[model samples]
Target: MVKEIERAGIPVVHVCTVVPISLTVGANRIVPAVAIPHPLGNPALGKEDEKALRKQLVLKALKALETEVQEQTVFDK
Candidate 1:
């Protein structure tokens, strides 16, 4: 779980379509995703576009990891 991972002193970024669930579970860093079926990428898009989208999400997650937060936070694209 995200909270458990953080409790171990490791930063975690929760990527999900529904942010409220991540907040409920006490995730410190949350990333709002595209959808439940395709949380990280839009399959309808061309392969290149999907790749770019995924890359952006990874970058956002990395940024979240680098930042310090005292409590729950959501990183929106």
Candidate 2:
């Protein structure tokens, strides 16, 4: 699906916990996520903190979409 979107000139940044699966499936831009069940948030965190974390992850994914890459890239920073 990610490749299909990119094939249509739409860039995709896949945000998920399973980095290897993302790579195996040929996701060009990937963001390492928090967990399998909740890829963007941590339940142990306070509500505000969880929201902040999710926002940060989203920002990272957006940044990845803006960048060009020749191979699978992990935007874990």
Candidate 3:
């Protein structure tokens, strides 16, 4: 689906816990997720902290989208 969306000229940033899978699937923009259960938030953290972390991850993904890349790129937080 990611590839198909990009094929249609819409860029996608895939936030996932599995980096290898994202790479294998040819996701042009990839963001490292916190974990499988909670891809954007860590339950161990306080609610506000978790929200902040999620926001940070989303910001990183947005930055990745703005970046120019010749090949698949993974943005780490």
* Predictions: Cα RMSD each: 0.8, 0.8, 0.8
Q: 65, model 1: CA deviation in Å?
A: 0.4
- Expressed as tens digits, the lDDT of each residue in 1-77 for candidate 2 is 88898789888999989999999988899999999999999999999999999999999999998898998899988
Lowest summed lDDT window (length 10), candidate 2: 2-11
Top candidate when judged by lDDT against the true structure: 3
Positional deviation of residue 52's Cα in model 1 after best superposition, in angstroms: 0.2
TM-score of each: 0.95, 0.94, 0.96
Better of 1 and 2 by lDDT: 2
At residue 9, candidate 3 shows an lDDT of 98
lDDT of each: 0.91, 0.92, 0.94
Model 3 segments more than 4 A misplaced: none
Clashing pairs in 3: none
- Mark the regions of model 2 whose C-alpha exceeds 4 Å error after superposition: none
| Tens-place lDDT digits, model 1, residues 42-61 | 99999999999999998998
Two-way TM-score contest, 2 vs 3, winner: 3
Name the candidate that leads on TM-score. Answer: 3
